[model samples]
Target: MSSVNLMAREVAAKIVFYGPGLSGKTTTLRKVYETVRPAHRGEMMSIATEGDRTLFFDFLPVKVERVGDCSVRLALYTVPGQVFYNATRKLVLQGADGVVFVADSQAEAMDANRESLANLEENLLENGIRLDRFPLVMQWNKRDLDNVLSVEELRRELNPRGVPDFESAATSGRGVMDTLKTITRLVIKDLRAKRIVPPPRPAPPPPGSAPAGLEAQLAQHLHHRQPPATTPPASTGSTAAAISATPVPRTLTAPAPPRVEPAAVPVVSANTGSKVLGPTSALAPGDLFDHARAAEAAFIAGDYTTCVTACTDAVRRAMAFAGEGSLAQQAFLLHVDGSDLLRLQGLSTLPQLRVDDAAFALYVLMQVFVRLNAVGLPTAG
Candidate 1:
């Protein structure tokens, strides 16, 4: 699965490195992580069992080349390979946009490689993905080891579909990048084919130019009308009448009062769950901003339930405005909820809805509003 964030100008896809135990799935991921520029890579996380084998998964987020105007971000994961960890493997394999089958090249490990490949297919099926049609790359690993199977033999055994295949010794970093590059390219191509990421939207027109369609109509509707010509006062001798008849300068209008900045509202911290001051800055006009403000007010007024409700509405409206087929909507679906509003509704029902919970919800909602506004919301005619 893939997610696009129009606000961030980023397209993210999941790529899983899968193979039998000791076939270098984790090592390959480490090599790639180390090779990537520090500015482009995030912290790598690995969950390991007491035996030092990966207990759950190893994750590395790397930003690669641009796909149109959006930078491509790849989340590389490796599933636990031990036989007993099959359940964990399947869980990690879900929503993978592409895969790299890192097969152990040692002749004795052929059976393990076959079993891992079969497991990959079965798990992909459970996720409703067909391996044959999916984007896949094969890496015949441990080529430096003795008693290793030939590339021809490995391909014949594992890569029957003949997807892009590479020969590598992951421990030495040989061919690691080649395998990664191929899988990434294939995954991006697949995304385009599936229309998961539509073409980069045309750039907005230059500022101050009359926009087309609904925007043009909105511009015209909001344009200020020129004031009608004022009649001069009839020749009055009074000082006040003379002052008025002198023809007031266009720049002499009364000055507007200074704006009063709102005090920062108290909200819960997302990471620590402690009370923190919410941003005092206002969001642009939209349903999202309105809902966020309502949530903030509810939190300040000690109405936890109402705060939660407003936060939920904010997410719902943000998702709706993001619309279908958009990266923003897909992100909400992937990371937030499939039934967009249900999760938030559950939060409102908690028996002792603490201030922290309500404040956190409002804080999250405000963050969403800020992001949507940063991207410039679509104007409604």
Candidate 2:
């Protein structure tokens, strides 16, 4: 089952990799972990036998994109493939939002693949999830091996429902990311359809005849501490009627000034030992100042939970302001102290909020504010 934490603005979904023994489920998962940025992924934990075969399951936590303002965290797991470990597989499959069936491509492993597929279906049924209706992705792994089954034969034998399937050589990382991406999309789509994750809010209307730009409107709302005003529909009546209407649009002859792009701030990743630009690196310092002030005020008021939540919202709003061209679009991991932003978000959802935790979150947010300030806002064009 997927869980949504409104306070943290996060949605978490579990995805399990299930396949026959030595079918490359663990290998596929490792490839995915390696491919993702270190800041976006947590440590991968594996419980395996002496022979390196998965005994229990491998767990990897990955933070992906946002559904609306909520970040989507995926818990990727791989079950032991041996028939004797069916109980372990069933346990891991419980509460799974999606599954990746990694079928061995060798012709000799057809029986193992079929049995594993049956076992998976049975386990999912036990957990109240119908395999046919559930989000699933099929991976014909080990394509580099000799005497491998063709994709067509594998599909006919294993994937009768014709779900999204991919051919892959997991060891060399061929098609592994493709399989993972498809399953993610399918799971998120399913979550949206079930209303477990809210659909993205519609984009606000652009500034029209109003003199104030969108940023100004945001600044005003943040500073004035008032509810955001809704954009009223255009009037189709006489000028007198339009003037008499409530919240009428202001007519301006001059065009809105062009925005100035701020200097990029380089963030060093401790895990990867790489320097990548932060997502809001190009935004003016003042762009996020209002949010920082709000967070600080919350902390001063001794509202620890609200302080943490405000910090999370500050980061989210910064990413949203960065637009689609920013590095955040590629990975949601805001590179402040290597996922401190995400950790701060998790802290906001704690049942017993601590003052120390809230203070640390505000400190991290201020660090971000300082970095942006150091670069200084460029002159408006």
Best by TM-score: 2
lDDT of 2 by residue, 1-381 (tens): 899865455799999999999999999999999999998998999989998999999999999977676789999999999999888998899999999999999999999999999999999888887899999999999999899988889989998898999999999999999998899999999998998986543443354632245434533443343222345545667765555554533222224223211222223443565654332332325666555555555543445566677677766655544346553441233334534665675675568554556667766666555444444422244
lDDT of 1 by residue, 37-124 (tens): 9978989999877866787999999989878866788999999989899999888888899999999999999999999999999999
Model 2 residue pairs with clashes: 1-95
What C-alpha lDDT does candidate 2 achieve relative to the native structure?
Answer: 0.73
Q: Residue 170 lDDT in model 2?
A: 94
Q: Using lDDT as the measure, which candidate wins?
A: 2
RMSD of 2: 14.5
State candidate 2's TM-score.
0.60
lDDT of 2 at 138: 96
